[model samples]
Target: MKTFTSPALSGLPGLRHAFFTRDGGVSKGIYAGLNGGIGSNDDPADVAENRRRMAEAMGVDVAHFLTAHQIHSPDVAVATMPWSPEARPRVDAMVTATPGLALGVTTADCGPILFADAKARVIGAAHAGWKGAFTGVLENTINEMEKLGANRADITVAIGPLIRQPSYEVGAEFVARFTEADPAFARFFIPSAREGHAMFDLAGFIRMRLQRAGIVDIDDTGIDTYPDEQLFSYRRTVHRKEPDYGRQIHAIVLAR
Candidate 1:
């Protein structure tokens, strides 16, 4: 199966990871190719098989490739071991320090961030939509990692493929919400053609947040999901008036 990795996390010892794209797997129509979103409308069997492929690629048992329900909240779930889909918690991020356990998060348009502290054998995965990011999901993920013995300075994070600034337009209220939280955030938005809308630099904003959290090593894939046919995009689905969309998986594991 096709996958991407960040240079920042690629050289880490005893870690395995992939930022998967919608290029491999068994699904049809809009959900074609590596659709791993367990909560999506895609057939359960297909999703299961796709996830199995991801787990195999990460060198873990199929049952060990774990992901959460992702409610776009700041909530984070710590994983000591794998859990069945029925037992997955309702959260937007996951962290793990246990060997042989994989932490994953699914996303279409939202950012999928993978983090690792090789020295501590700790790793994290987060779904950073605008709501989740603004509300502190990234921060919460790091805090949980620290609780598991990861140091912020030792952490290396990768911002995976997502809707980039050029394709991400926001309403005035969206801009206001961010600026209200911190006026300096206004720089992430640039005026768009729409009277009250502006383009948002989501990746840049995410990087700044990581910097503020004391993380020094960061890498962004710089791949935009919206126009990339190889990746699934919720906004692209919406714009096409499709009834549903697929999601790609981003996972990191502390290898056994």
Candidate 2:
């Protein structure tokens, strides 16, 4: 399977992480290539086998590879052990200090952020869509990691693939939501070709938030999922009128 690693997290000791691409899996058609999204409509067996491969790559047992039932909320969960798919927490982010457990987040166009504090042996994975990022999922993930003995300054974050601003145009109300939250947020948007619409810089906004939270060691793969065929994109799928889309799994694990 193809995977991308960030330099900030790659040099860290005692942990493993990957920003998996839409490559190397058994699923066919729309769900092909490492579709680890359990909530997706792909064949259950195919999804399971794909996840097994991801878990193996992370050096964790398949059962220990955990992802939440993401709701695009700012909620965060702390994982102490493996949970069955039926029992996955309904949250946007997860943190764990426990070794042998992989914290994962599934995404198509949303941002997949992997975090680690090697000194504290704490790791986190957050699924940050526009709503989740605006509502504070990134901050919550850092706070949860702090609670697990991670110092914010010591935590290195790696942002994975997501739809870039050029491919992410939004209506007036979407721009209003961010500006209403903070007028300064208006800078994150630029005029789009369509009237009453603007291109939103999701990655830039995410980076701003992390900096505001005092995380200096941050690395972004800077891979835009929308135009990149190697990655899956929800918007791309929608524009094409496809029935369903695949999701790439990005995970981080503290070594045992």
Candidate 3:
């Protein structure tokens, strides 16, 4: 399967991660290639097989390849052992210092952020959509990692593919939500051609949140999922009037 890795986390000792694209999998139709989203309408068997591939890539057993039942909330989970799909926690991020358990987050256009503090051997995966980022998922992920003995300054974060500002147009309320939270956030929005609409910079906002959380080592894949054919995008699926959409899984694991 085709995947992207962040340079910041690539050379970290005992770390393995991948920002998987919708490139390789057995599913056909709209769920084609590496649709790891259990909540998606894709065939269950195909999803299992796809996750198995991801687990193998991360050098862990399929059972140990973990992802939460994301709710776009700031909730974070600490994974010490694998949980069944039916039992996945309702959270947007996960952190772990335990070796062999791969933490993953499923997303289409939402940001997938992988974090690692090599010195502490702690790793985290966060699903940072606008709501999650605005509500503190990124900071919560770091806090959870800190609880596991990670130092925020020693942590390195890699932001994976997501909807970039150029392709992410939002209504007035969306812009209002950010600016209302902090007037300074207005800078992340640019007027779109459509009236009462603006392009939102999700990546930039994510980076800002990381920096604000005191994380200095960061990297971004800079891939826009909306226009990238290799990646699945929820907004693209909606624009095309497709009945359902697939999701890509971005994951991290400590191999020690």
Candidate 4:
């Protein structure tokens, strides 16, 4: 299957990880390629097989490739072992110190961020959509990692493919939320041609949040998912009036 690896995470020791794309799987149509989203309308067997491929690629067993039912909240789960798909928690992020278990999150246009502190052997994965990020998912994920012995100073984060600012136009109220949170957030929004609408720099805001959280190392792929046909995109699908869109998986694991 086609996948992208973060150079930041690659040099880290005792870790295996990947940000998978929509390619090289048995799925067909819009869900074609390795669609690992268990919540999509795609056939369960197909998603299962796709995730199985991802598991093998990440050097984990099928049962060890874990993900959660994301609720766009600040909730973060700690994984000691993989939960059955039906049993996954309603959380937007996860952290793990356990070896051989892969922690993953699914996304289309939303941000998929992977974190690791090599010395601590702790890894984290977060689904940072505007809601989750605004609600503090990234910070909570790091806090959970600290509970597992990770250090913020030693942590390195890699932001995988996501919808860049140009493709992320938003309503005034949406902009209001951030500006209300902190006046500085206004810098992340640029005025759009449409009155009261603005383009948002989602990836940039995420990077800023990571930095403020005290993480010393950060890598942004700077790949825009909406314009890149190689990656799946929720906003793209909506604009095209597609019935459904598939999600891609971003995962990290502690090597066995």
Candidate 5:
């Protein structure tokens, strides 16, 4: 039931952020409480309740809640009410300077990042999976917030619970992707127990990327999804052959 509200962003009274764990919902078994994804096998009622509670916890109306279709792309969307829950946009990042909107991102071993520049009243949330991160979702999200009047330097951000370095082993080809992008990133990977494979530090690489983006306020609580029983993990569930899995939610809201 632990909630991680980064001290880095806590000084911004105008912003609300929550890195929720698996403790507050009605879901059971693999999709236990607070499972918000309707796409999962969790009961529709449970999913609805999870979303309802998440919105309530953040003190925003459920309808003000916003998220993308989450294609793992770097695209960012500006939130406008007359909200469209029906037409999910094919994007993984969302930003808004407008008040009364809750920008959200879902994750299961992938990074969920919440950003805020209270001075400009701009906020953003991004789903930065490895693929999305590789494609520059973090930078794109910061760019979107800037478009809405945020200064990247002033924007405080917290990267929430995700798979950690030791828990994330990948093949050499995968390691090649980052090295290919920028040879400097090669240091983030180290040889794992498996042959030709290495353990990748996703959060560390993201921090480096954000730092390169000129963002100063950055931090991660270092919660690992794969080993943590509370947080949901797609990779963990898949390897276990579980029928379905739940998604952990990471959300931020601008005070009304």
Candidate 6:
């Protein structure tokens, strides 16, 4: 099967990003192939080798790849240049004005949003899980990109590999959180099987947030991680009573 990836990375002027699927790596068992999550129980050597392969594919220095601590918070990181791999930054979104530094973020079921403004020569990658989305991580990423000269109108945003609404059954408490965030959000939830559970549209909510930020070139590929066995899924893994799951990486680099 073909691995799922973001098309927004294609044809951009000196920019690169991939929504790497679960293929072409050394991790065995549940981690299987292309398992890039360092946080996962996958072997450190396998994880490092997988990261090296992704960097080589993106045409950047394997040493220059940067990712966050990812607390599911809304904080954003602005990269001045290549960050040391030894320093794990504690932020969800990474915006880079300096070229050639690949900003990487991991997701198993959360939305990995890639941003690029050809005119501004800027790119950003964000890990927006439910909590981060509710707290405005997407908005913060866009705002930080603008600080580096990307106009919202000129920026193109693409959301990659997520558990679609049909596969994402949430509890009433989850539905209530959005309703409390904004009554308009109540509409984003649809009735699901079983009482007190609703189907949440994660990608739709992401596009809505981007549109609200005035970026509407939304490319939602409709890839559902939970149902697709090729890629990993946190929820699906949990539902299957698995011990742990791998995380795919969404990374972007801008050439200076």
Runs of candidate 6 exceeding 4 Å displacement: 1-3
Model 1 lDDT per residue over 115-184, tens place: 9999988899999998898889999999999999999999999999999999999999999999999999
Instruction: Count the clashes in each prediction.
Output: 0, 0, 0, 0, 4, 0
For candidate 6, write residues 35-61 as lDDT tens digits: 889889999999999989888887887
Minimal lDDT window, size 10, model 6: 1-10
lDDT of 3 at 107: 97
- Please name the candidate that would achieve the greatest lDDT relative to the true structure: 3
TM-score winner between candidates 3 and 6: 3
RMSD of 4: 0.8
TM-score of each: 0.98, 0.99, 0.99, 0.98, 0.96, 0.96
Better of 4 and 5 by TM-score: 4
Clashing pairs in 2: none
**Cα lDDT of all candidates, in order?**
0.92, 0.93, 0.95, 0.93, 0.86, 0.87
Model 4 ranges off by over 4 Å: none
lDDT of 5 by residue, 82-134 (tens): 27667767799998887888888888889998899988999999999898888
Predicted structure 2, TM vs. truth? 0.99
In model 3, which runs have C-alpha deviations exceeding 4 angstroms? none
Model 3 has an lDDT value of 0.95
Q: Which stretches of candidate 1 lie over 4 Å from their true place?
A: none
What shift in Å separates residue 86 of candidate 4 from its native position after superposition? Answer: 1.0
